[model samples]
Target: MILTRAEELCRERGVQFTALRREVLEAVAASEPPPGAYDIAERLSRPGRRVAPVSVYRALDFLMELGLVHRIASRNAFVPCAHAHGIGENVVFLICRTCGGIDETTSPEVESGLGKTLKRAGFTPAHSILEVEGDCGACRDKARGAG
Candidate 1:
């Protein structure tokens, strides 16, 4: 389903979903706690086939542009969007500092509030990446147990 959505998006945008791009997207989606470009390259590499850092970076850039993936700036990693249709400007990333977990969420009220604030400031926002870092439920539970 994700691959099909990616292909559909590429067709709609008149872009080519090359093999490398597809591989990169799959790598990112399969990652447990997201993965950096170098990590993606390493994961895709095998005995006969070698994936380069530059190639992975290029693929990541393309995937990000197409909204098939998102770069978590705080962690310097890329993760697949929960919504294949693409993440909109109002998306939020909840990052767990304890275990490196990430959850993508969106709130309509937050989006409307941000839009109003931007409008008032006379700023035309191109993209909004709101990342909230904290401990996830399991991590918190572990902390409590340790305490």
Candidate 2:
């Protein structure tokens, strides 16, 4: 679904979704945890041929521009975003410290309130993805059981 949507978006925007971009997106989607550019490059490398980090970074940049993937700055990794968000939408990434997992959700209230506040302060924001770090439900439950 994501691949199809990405392709459609690329066509609509007059952008070329190259084979390398598709492969990079596939690798990111398949990862359990988000993967870094170097990690992805290493994974895609063949026996004799090596995938360059610069190439992976370029692919990542393109995917991010199209909103097919997002960068988790804290972890220095990229994750395939399942949701198709619009402009100025607020996406919150719930990052689990214990299990190293990430879950994404959106809040209209947050967007509305933040938008109002930023407006009042005469501030214009470039990006809106928020990352909150904590232990996830399964990890918390497991820790309690162990306790």
Candidate 3:
């Protein structure tokens, strides 16, 4: 994940960064996969930051609302939002069951299709997340016992 020019963003939003918040954001930025609250707590503890799980969770909530994060529902984890400023477009996530890898993509076709279906059903989508599960190549190879 790439961070914005910190000075620029902070200036724009009048946002102040605390040490713990910075650490948490950096950890999330550096995570190979999206991290759950527990995962974040563990990492924070390892660094001797002494940040509590609840605190980390609260920080995550703030970051998400700030448009700096995205949650992967299937994994119950959070990832840095690719779009830093824009409210994210609806995304479809391909999640790997074995290795926990995730790939996010957008599909207007899917959005319109689902919207039309929901409209017909007398429902409107205020929010949506479409997650597809499968084994990633590495995990598939691991199960097959191939080096």
Give the lDDT of residue 144 in candidate 2. Answer: 96
- The model with the greater lDDT, 1 or 3, is 1
**True-structure lDDT of candidate 2:** 0.89
Whole-model lDDT per candidate = 0.87, 0.89, 0.75
Give lDDT tens digits, candidate 3, residues 40-129: 888889554467899998878767766677788777987776554456468777788877777666788998899889999998667777
Collision count for each candidate, in order = 0, 0, 0
For candidate 2, lDDT tens digit of each residue in 1-147? 889989999999999999899999999988878889999999899999888999999999999888889899889989888698873456888899988888888888888899999999999888766899999999999999999
Give the residue spans of candidate 1 off by over 4 A. Answer: 85-88
Tell me how many residue pairs clash in candidate 1.
0
**Strongest candidate by TM-score:** 2
How large an RMSD does model 3 have? Answer: 2.9
In candidate 1, position 104 carries an lDDT of 88
TM-scores for all candidates: the values are 0.88, 0.92, 0.80
Residue ranges of candidate 2 with Cα displaced over 4 Å: none
For model 3 the TM-score comes to 0.80
Cα error, residue 19 of model 2, in Å, equals 1.3
